[model samples]
Target: MLIKYLGHAAFLIRNVEGIRIITDPYSPTQGIHYKPIDENADIVTVSHEHWDHNAVDLVGGNPVVIRKEGERSVRGITITGIPTFHDKEGGKERGENTVFVFDIDGLRLCHLGDLGHKLNKEQISLIGRVDICLIPVGGYFTIDVKEAKEVIESLNPKVVIPMHFKTSSLDFPIAGVEDFLKGTERVKRLGSSEYEIEKDKSPLEREVIVLKPAKSS
Candidate 1:
C-alpha cells in the first residue's frame, strides 16, 4: 500500500486493489487549507468530531465517514471501526473517537483518530494486532509525547507513524516533533511526505517513523 502523510492526521492510502482511502482531511491552520494530489477517494475515515480532524468538506470525491464502531467494505479493503474514548477516561471535551483498521491484502493498518488520552486495557484488546499504526502525538487535545510512548508500548505495532504534532500552523499551541522523540532512540526520520509499504517485506521489529508533512498549497 502507498501511504502519504498530508500533515496532521490526514493521509492518502492506496490499497492492494488500487483503491485510494483518505483519512481526516483538515485545514492546515484554522483558516487555511492544503491541496491534495488526489482529492477524491474510494473511502474516507474520520476518527472524531473535532473541527480539524473531521474536515470532510475539504476533501473532494465521494467519501463516506465512519461515525462509530462498525465494519464497511469499499472495493477490496475491509475497514473495521473500533470505538474508543477521546480522552483518558472518555471524559474529554470531544467525547469519543473511532480507531479504524484497514485490512488490505494481508496488511492490517490502524489509524488512531484524534485520540485524546491513552487507551485502556479493554480498548487495547479490541485493537488486536496492527502492522502499521497512524497515531496522533499532539498534547492539547490528544496524547502528548510521554503518554504516546505508553500507548505505543501497549499496542505493540510493527511500525508506528507519529502525526498531529506541531507544524507551520500553530492554530493549536502544542509541542513539536522533537517532543515526541525526546526519550525514544533510533527513530527513522524519512524526509519524504509520502511512503510506500508492501506486504512482501518483513515488518520492523520496533520502529518510530517521522515523516514530513505534505507541502500545503
Candidate 2:
C-alpha cells in the first residue's frame, strides 16, 4: 500500500489494486494553501462533521462515505471505526471523533482523526493491534505532544505518522512537528510526502516516520 500525506490530516491511501481511500479531505479555507484535491477515491472516511475533516464535496467521484462508529467493508477493504472524542472534555468542548482501523494490502492501519485525549483501556482494546498509526500530535484542537506519546506507548504501532500540526501553510494555533520529535529515537524523515509499506517488511520495533506534504495538484 502507498500512503501519501496531502497536508494537514488529509491522506491518500492506495491499495495494490489501485483502489484509493482518502481520509479527512480538507477544504481550501482551512488556513492552508495548496492545490485542491482532484483525485478520485473509492472510499472516504470523515472523522467528524467539522469543516477541515469532512470536506467530502472536494473529493472527486461518488465515493462511499463512512463517518459513524461501526464495521464497514468496501471494495474488499474492511474498516472499523472506534468511537473517540475531539477534545479531552469528552466531546463537550469540541465534539466526537472516530478512529478508523482498517487493512490495506495486508497491512493493518489506524487513523486517529483529530484525537484530543489519551486512550483509555477500553479505547485501546477496541483499536487492537495496528501496524501503522496516523496520529495527531498538535494541541488545542487535538492531543498535544505529551498525550500523543502516551497514546503511542499504549497502541505500540510499528510505524507512527504524526499529523495535524503547524506547517508553513497551516495557521492553526498548534506546535510544529518538531515538538513531537524531540529526543525520539529511530526516527526516519522521508523528505517526500509519500511512503510505501508492505506487510513482510514491517518494522520489528516502534519507529516514527515523518513525511513531507505531497505537491498539490
Shift of residue 64 alpha carbon in model 1, Å? 3.1
Could you tell me how far off, in angstroms, the CA of residue 99 lies in candidate 2 after the best superposition?
Answer: 0.4
TM-score of 2: 0.97
How many Å off is the CA of 62 in candidate 1? 1.3
Per-residue lDDT tens digits of candidate 2, residues 160-204? 999898887777889999999998999999989999999999889
User: By summed lDDT, which 10 consecutive residues of candidate 1 come out lowest?
Assistant: 29-38
Instruction: Report the lDDT of model 2 for residue 186.
Output: 95
lDDT of the structure predicted as candidate 1: 0.79
Identify the runs in model 1 with alpha carbons over 4 angstroms from their true place.
28-38
TM-score, candidate number 1: 0.91
